[model samples]
Target chain A: MNAPQRIVVDPVTRIEGHLRIEAETDASGKITRASSAGTMVRGIEIILRGRDPRDAWAFAQRICGVCTLVHGMASIRSVEDALHRAIPSYSIPRNAEIIRNLMIGAQYVHDHVMHFYHLHALDWVDVVSALKADPKATSSLAQSISNYSKSSPGYFADVQKKVKTFVEQGQLGIFANAYWGHPAYKLPPEANLMAVAHYLEALAWQRDVVKLHAIFGGKNPHPNFVVGGTPSAISVHSSSGAAKARGGQDGTAVNMVGLQTVQTVIKQMKDFVDQVYIPDLLAIASFYKDWGAIGSSGGNYLSFGDMPEKDIWTPDSFLIPRGVILDGDISKVHPINMDDDNEIQEFVSHAWYKYKDGDDKGLHPWKGETEFNYTGPKPPYEQLDVDQKYSWLKSPRWKGKPMEVGPLARALIMYATGNKQMKELVDYTLKTLDVPVAALFSTLGRTAARGLESKVIADAMQGMFDSLIANIKAGDVKTFNEQYWDPASWPKSMKGVGLMEAPRGGLSHWMVIEDGRIDNYQAIVPSTWNAGPRDTAGNSGPYEASLQHNHVLHDPKQPLEILRTIHSYDPCLACAVHVTDPEGEELIQVKVK
Target chain B: MSLEDIRVVVDAGESSPYQADALSGNAPVLLRELAEHVRQLMAAGEPTAIDLNALPLTPADLDWLKATLGEGEISVTLHSDGESTLAETACPGVWWVTHHNESGHVVSRFIEVAFVPELVKAHPEDVKTGLEYLESLIFDLS
Candidate 1:
């Protein structure tokens, strides 16, 4: 007797957040259908009701532990928009913008490094495979780029021995319970060993970079990054420790200047991006060129775009231009005004609630509604088709079309707008990485571009930081808010929108208020744009539509093909998070069908 | 019988399992509605996302579904037999159906929750509210 097909991967570890994927095959064992289930409901939206508008940023960052900074940005901007605070600056002061840029850049460094080694690597490089790796070859690869080559079994070689010992001791808790001997473990054992070494090194650096966030804002996981202005200001004199000194504490050290701590880290990361990361991606890409086609949903691209002026938070001097790329061709490129430019709505026919048609219009976050219904009853789209009703996320649209938002989108938007530095960097990176310029147009290109862009931003921030230090030495340090503008100072009747290029992708916060209490506050987070469910017009989310065309090359057991495509979206599920509804009341009492 | 001792009756045979129609009705619209409602409520001053894994026993929530149905049959692919008190007096189908009903309720209310047995077995402390779920799984209405 043929056993029926059954596959369940619960508690997907490593990626930050709770999501379970349940995919099943029919009688013949093909993935005819699948559903990605989000687990955990803290009722964050429910908790935010009626809170003071200015305090919304502090509360919103609590939504996810990973993308807390983006949440903070969205939350702060939402209030800023609601209050109609025309953030002052022709160009945010050079020192202020540089300070802001370096802080945000530090966050990307934390995210990308953690992502490359921790989340996606173990899928291909087995924990068990490390025990079999040739230690000398692994050591050589690390030493080649590290510039600290030692004939004696050095740091990397020692790290490898420790890992092998653990693996031999059945202590695979590092990547415990993973599919160790899967067919996708194709890299030479030494590469796997080298990657494992970097994995540990990256984790430490990830932790070390938080001081950057703490110095500027409060802390990270979610840094307290202000949108219109930063919480911390610029200064040269260091009687008080503004931020932890980079590698040393005393002023005598070459790299231990105040903001320069972040500057140096950014520099280190920039070198890694330019010299190590880009080349590493190319080498990895060489082995996996087939991945280029797995996640091409062919949706138009968009970027709310970012401005990195002297005032980095305000929407003034843009690093990239705004608008849409329809069907891979440049279409209508217009200034982004959420009011005249955007239309958003929610559809429940395919969801769990009972509503008359058109009952739920798209309301920004503050004015939005979140009512609880606990019924493991019908699928949301039971009224519609099952094919359409799988995800809990309501699809978000830019001008009612599936538009991809990420580095690739941001880079292309920058190029289309003719920003000289962004354009030049894009070309330079393509040549430096030896990737065709056109490759910068795809998903892998987007992933690689994010790292490269990080380099560009890092380089720019370093320049800004240097100038800021010079200004401070010249006794021109500016921090702290001016006269505390009571809520009355904000234009109550007016409405506004704010945009940012968050780590996950493009982010926007829109607000409208009546008498200053936040009559409406809506934020389109990166994940909302990336993992968006189907929209009202039945358009699939960029990731959703793209998944349909991917070819799962290996057995379903080794889902590298799937994970590769999905992770390329660089999805920060933690950025927007996911929510699944509860079953309704029938379970309380017995019922006869 | 006390609601706790009352046995559930599930339909038998090789047919498709008894449908939890009540559970099904809310799946699609409730989450988005809850997202909206909590959003509006936050505006109007309520901040709560529907807990997908936590079912309500409050009168307003399940009271209607329970009042209308009183008791309905459901079929579930079995995991294991319940406790002695469960198996001693209740039909296996009855026990399974009752647990399924309550499980579905809990599943509906939670915005996001984990109840898969294997996953629970792995990290049960973080996810399993075996105690919270016990009341519904048992047929007592005290």
Candidate 2:
């Protein structure tokens, strides 16, 4: 039957970095299960094992060019927690927290805006449809939206011209490989025109917001963070050495004038997150009414809450307390237990690690064993099917369960907690978009909720920033604590897991120090949780479970719909591997070992 | 006065015979010499702080530098009219000096460095890289 129709989509278009999807269907094309395979596995874990604990944070951040700071925060905080280290006081002022929140808010805006317009837009907006849209109507409509105009005359006209140029030149950004003009690629021509125009605008603005990271953490993608404390140098001296860790004060904050300019920039960027970003999300959600029924995955959710106390940077007193929701039930919040944090274990069985049957199952660092000898990659699943068992990724189970991550998990946790602002914004959004009250539980809800959270986070950040400025003006700004304790001075054994709610979801580092070196240093990153393969019992990873039963239309060649559903999860498969044939060809296969 | 320091302990398993070859790549000779110096210093209290301002860093130090500092710049080059206007290197304020055998070795033990919190605050990004570099250097290469 035409060689069992195989579709291999390598270098998945319109996402940061690279990924490939290979799926196969049976004869008469009814369809069997599919294997989501990953082509790249550049040994980030093994490389991290022997490095300095602090350096691990920076290196880990590089694992994904997109989720950089999240990794950095997770890694650093993990080490600090393991060592029972704490930063100084006078660093956790409202301004300090606000500044941190602002940076994070900026990143969220940049990532979400980029995700909506650049990556996923093509799935719904046919680029070719822009030519048919009345430019005059587009401009008038754009003008009507107070947030969408350019002061420059004929500027809207120029943006439209650029969209036309992009379409004509076929420069689809990294979206070069995405399905731009395929059927099932829904959305009206006008919608496509509007989205395409915004895609171009967001690209430029995303850069401006990214600079926010540079101002604070010191770079985009991976920024320098303050763990166990705030970042910035001495607010007291505002000079050499004193103002080292602090981003402001010292020469770091020397620009009183620049602060005003920076604030203006942040406000402008904030306008997009509040006005354009959220509205765009709500607008898009309106058309995909059925997403609620299709996109939900797993019953277990986790959050190692972030944002510390108003005047404290102690790991003990984190902002978002670590808690897990079992079976969609948010009845009571339990503290994150590293020992009891079962349900999550990586089965190197299908991955490139030598372990007992490839299920490299272990609790975490403190309680974990130090047997890191390597053999080769093994098929984690017990049942063997050579055709699909050669990938380097392991199937990790959370509480022996498949847990979903990303903004959805964060949104759910926030939603369950009665976050008044989040609830208000989401509730209003649902009404404005004409979605069912319950649609807040679906995929589109996740997409919109993440954008809405950006606003809440931005507003919160402004508070943190101002407080920090006041602290600086009050003559206090030391965020670094350089205390080194002797390994022999105390505990020979301490097993602790450092937790944080990374932008992607839960991020943790399990560390064990014996005789002073990292006797066992293992990290369960967000990507690892999101993109794992099947466990021995054969439960799918979070994204895999979400993709189950997505009705594949007539031709499998046009998969932009399924891709949009999955990309919404923002799979950082770089850290997690998937099943693939040794031939390195396609993604369609049920033959998993 | 509170003592300000950040300890970076590296794994020095390369001395294990099974991994002699891989451990001593372009580094063995230099590390051996540094190890000898560390072995001598072990009897004294281990000084984990290394002032970069006072460094003519040896090969072992270089390895430690790359590991700990990562791929970020140590200095910002402010330019005027497209020309280098100011080039001030970060002091990296504080440092760590790792003595081998947990400060027990007398001859074969070696030492590497990382950033102390003070220096880390100065070049915050490098603090992490430096710590990582120490982790890599002090690891049991075997």
Candidate 3:
């Protein structure tokens, strides 16, 4: 019997923030155990304390640059929810809801596309092999997959030349420090070349589509978020000749030109997702069929449904349904009782946080503490003490179960709970790949689910836009409900949970507003659920379980397989930490007696 | 009603403490990279360019960098996508190039360590096309 070799990947690149993964592989190179550690900490919740509840979104929005708009949306939704619960008339306009949908839906499509092409695609596609590809064959291969119009032989040749020039330059830039020639990369030269071209195209595509956010929210990457409704105002002058005099309506307001731009961007987004993204996803996924059976998270899934038609209070109107699926049972979907303390709780037994009562006790977000207790080995160390506090992320469990969140969870809930469009899309993916329904539980399935949902959300964005237009046409241009704007109409103390299906996964911001100020604010992000360490019950997180399931590192030195499974979750570790900087003084100085 | 009138600023004392200076402690690191790039160009005679847009350089850092490198004799403007300026730094073989989109937004910026920046030079295919055009003009004259 041979001893299991431990492989550690500290500071995983191409992710939003710092994440370290340590896996132990057996004699046959199959991973037996894995630990995920979120290395950075930011005291966002503590900073939000004593701040105006309405202004908390601006601060919370800085959680992650990649997940830019989600935290802002959630924070505003928390405020809105708290105020609405207090006052019956605290509701946003229909146009506001539609606009919010459009914004978040765009986020889903944009984030998923960027994640696929820029982040996860490199795990499967070999760039160095792409240099040897025949441009003509690559064009044919691309044309056969999708009519993206950029599939001309000359176009591929030019791209190939550009890449050749870049490689010749000797500075690979972001493409450096990657496991380029690793055996885990399975795509052929032509496929790799096609994918490489789309990678660059997606970068440009994302830059243009994110302008939709800027149009509505006033900027991309931490877009402006208002409490009751969208921040942008609708221009009445657009219908009359006054708009032209005002330079085609105010740039700050949503006018005909801005709407036209939104429509064009949506069309471009839908076309690219339909033509390039999905087709490329299918083409590349067909080659890596074995990943269909690998990286399963014990078949537990959760999705706090998003893209609401009305508001967060009503779950029935959500495009992505909220439910919990335990032990791979698609037939039985359990409703999420968010208010119940035991239903959704965070434990820090194996994490770097301390609960006043005990580390093993799970506390609801309403009573969640942000106390930091570093009990593991210091930084610049070789390994983590997996048995002790090894991570900054507190393990968030739904009903005492380690449930996987994000695209795969949402996809499964949608399929199980019967979302027509999502069902057809998931079925189509399975049928095209010739894999079974169980394949939807693996790393490849997780990646495919992201593309499928992106298409659904992109298509849904058109409906949201049309609804907004119709509302505006019907002489309702009210973008904000200022009835709740005055904090004087607020209750003395109130708490609310803002749940949304962030592009990454189920994200919820729990806020306790006391006397018009934020008493406590805690955001339980998707990555915390996916990348958290072992809980008190000793249940490994989604990342750890997936790595231990069927992951076998061909070369432990080049752990490309580990990256594929982890990147599948689109891990944003910066969103997970709720503590202050370890080196700096405590942001709030919570006394631990 | 004007954009300039809407002012909202949060003063965090002399320094924000949260926002790190782009080149404060890392000027030497970037200078070291530039030096290595320059060294490679000198020893191997291989040209290289650093994408300034890719780096986290603040506006002040950019000004400081420009001041450190200073200006050279050559400065060329090319109207392609929109407008591009390729200027040589005081240090020979170091060029500062900035490219803008059609809307005049700075799309890409780079620091090129080359005798002539790549964007300023005509491609071999374009040169061939230029010769063909010249031949056509001669034929018309004849």
Q: What C-alpha lDDT, on a 0 to 100 scale, does residue B25 get in candidate 2?
A: 47
Q: In model 1 chain B, which range of ten residues has the least summed lDDT?
A: B83-92
Q: After superposition, which runs of candidate 2 have C-alpha atoms over 4 Å from their true positions?
A: A1-6, A24-32, A85-102, A143-146, A151-153, A169-177, A226-231, A234-250, A253-258, A310-321, A330-335, A341-343, A357-390, A485-495, A577-593, B1-142
Give per-residue CA lDDT, model 2, range A24-77, as digits (tens).
566644334445555566655555654455566776677667766666666666
By DockQ, the candidates rank as 3, 2, 1
DockQ of 1: 0.01
Write the residue-wise lDDT of candidate 1 on A1-593 in tens digits.
22344455545666656544444555444443444434334545444444456666776677667655766766665655444345342223355555656666676666766666777666556666766777777667656645422312466568777976776787666567667787766767766776776677667666657767766775666666553456664422233222122122222222234344555465667665655555555555555554444466564787776645633234456554556666766434555555543444333323323232242344333234433322332432122123544344445665666677877777677677776777787777566556665555455666666666666565665665666555655555554344323566655464555567776777765555555554545556676676665555666666655555444435656555556555666665544542322222433553312
Once fitted onto the true fold, the runs of candidate 3 whose alpha carbons sit more than 4 angstroms away are A1-3, A245-247, A580-593, B1-132, B139-142
Record all residue pairs in model 3 with backbone atoms less than 3 Å apart, i.e. clashing.
none
Judging by lDDT against the true structure, name the best candidate.
Answer: 3
Q: Classify candidate 2 by CAPRI docking class.
A: incorrect
- For model 1 chain A, the run of ten residues with the poorest summed lDDT: A242-251
TM-score of 3: 0.82
True contacts recovered per prediction: 0.00, 0.00, 0.00
Kindly provide the TM-score obtained by chain B of candidate 2 when compared with the true chain B: 0.20
Question: lDDT for every model?
Answer: 0.53, 0.55, 0.85
lDDT of 3 by residue, B60-101 (tens): 466567767889999999998899999999988999998988
